[model samples]
Target: MVFKRMLQALGVGGPSVDAVLTSPDCRPGGTLEGAVQILGGDHPVDVEYLAIGLLTRVEVESGDSEYHTDQEFHRQRLTGSFRLEPGARHDVPFTFPVPWQTPITEVYGQHLHGMTMGLSTELEVARAVDKSDLDPVAVHPLPAQERILDALLRLGFRFGRADVERGRVYGVEQELPFYQEIEFYPPPPFARGINQLELTFLPTPRRLQVVLELDKRGGLFTEGHDAFGSFDVDYATVDQVDWVAKLDGWLRQAAQRRGLLF
Candidate 1:
């Protein structure tokens, strides 16, 4: 009995945990469902809680260069105060709501390169905890989000890169501490007038606030600077509005209205 207790204390013959996600792909503001499977070894163990954390790897600017950092955006506790006997097996199922402001990891089923996101499971047993399993999660854009992206793509803008900044966008209501910026390289039409464009989306129950930042290229007589514009629209407008034409017009207006203070 002493040897058995020692083995259990060392976790040599204790419980093992595995979490399986129902689907690999999910949309922002959608539900993520999964199950945690636990298997007992040679002895019984008191399981305290089963927790799943949703984490995303983000890039942040530090002085001159950028660094990769991991952030846990959300978590869900599936079970608490459970006991597993020797040779016992149990499955704990859970469903969690993904925040509307969740960052997009993929565009149209294609994983954005260099984007790292996953769901990690932690099993709390007694006074010890173990984080032994991680599963990759794919987050796709919502319908309204896709509409805007499609419009930009059709407007001859190429995706540059995406990053989450620590600050909030000006003139927008946001719940999340950080906001996502999706930068785009300008095409021929706006190349001379603009250096780059940054897009940010703040979603609410009724509408989404779209913020556009235009980085203007400095000419021989002018200094380089940025121009900003924000608009709010309901989901219904996504289908009714000609977003491509509307966005193009906005860019052109920004270019002509140079040096105009926001």
Candidate 2:
């Protein structure tokens, strides 16, 4: 979705700007190519610069409460010191590299609920800058990511929800300000001992950091709490590992390690 608005800084008769993204669906570290179209108004305008900003919605925890906020992570200048004549049509094309640590917005072609991402355009006409147009964008997981998710689904774990948190995970190297946590309901055999499961993936050029948090169920003599486990896996193992069995084993071990199951 794209929204367009006249450059308010340029006054009522100023030029209008529209940003169109060629590829709305992209993966992390991929190149996003798009063109910013500028339509001149009744007179010539001195456009100082044209820029694009990448925006996403993030959750922040404040003391005893949590709230959602809009964040702009990336920005670039597409054009500088350009002149537009009356009724002139100009297109400035741009290709920007997405950050490698950008959060995943979709999985298995399904959009994650409660996530909103967009590409916003900024036009500066003689210091009358307008940042009103925003284009929605979608991000998907990589090949290795798909393998892990497939493994979980094959193990009978159902998708509970997915969200982005504004803090870093313990003992993990992160580049972005936020990370994605995908939660799932436990399957049978382990369901009796575990309340919920949360997965966090931090990917690098060569390997992926997998963090698993299990909410253990309590018994008459035990108290309920969370059990955290982290490991690193190479991309080559995506096809080599028997993910279904491996994931099942991981869950069983995690439950036992936390004393959830005897």
Q: For residue 119, what is the lDDT in candidate 2?
A: 88
Give lDDT: candidate 2, residue 39. Answer: 93
| Separate clash counts for every candidate | 0, 0
Model 2 whole-model lDDT (C-alpha atoms): 0.82
Best by TM-score: 2
Q: On a 0 to 100 scale, what is the lDDT of residue 89 in model 1?
A: 87
Where does candidate 1 have its weakest 10-residue lDDT segment?
Answer: 124-133
**73-186, model 1: which lDDT tens digit per residue?**
788888887888998988988887888787888997676665677888887788434435788888888888888889999999999878777656777788777778888998
Local distance difference test values of all predictions, in order: 0.81, 0.82
Clashing pairs in 2: none
Error of 2 at 241 (Å): 1.4
Kindly list the per-residue Cα lDDT of model 2 for residues 1-262, writing each as its tens digit.
1122344343656788998889898887787898989999876778888888889988999999999999988899888888888899988888977876777888878987777888888877774555358998898887878888889888888888888889889898788888888898978777888888888889888788888999888889888899999877788767888878888888888788777783
Q: What are the runs in model 2 whose C-alpha is more than 4 Å off?
A: 1-10, 127-129, 218-223
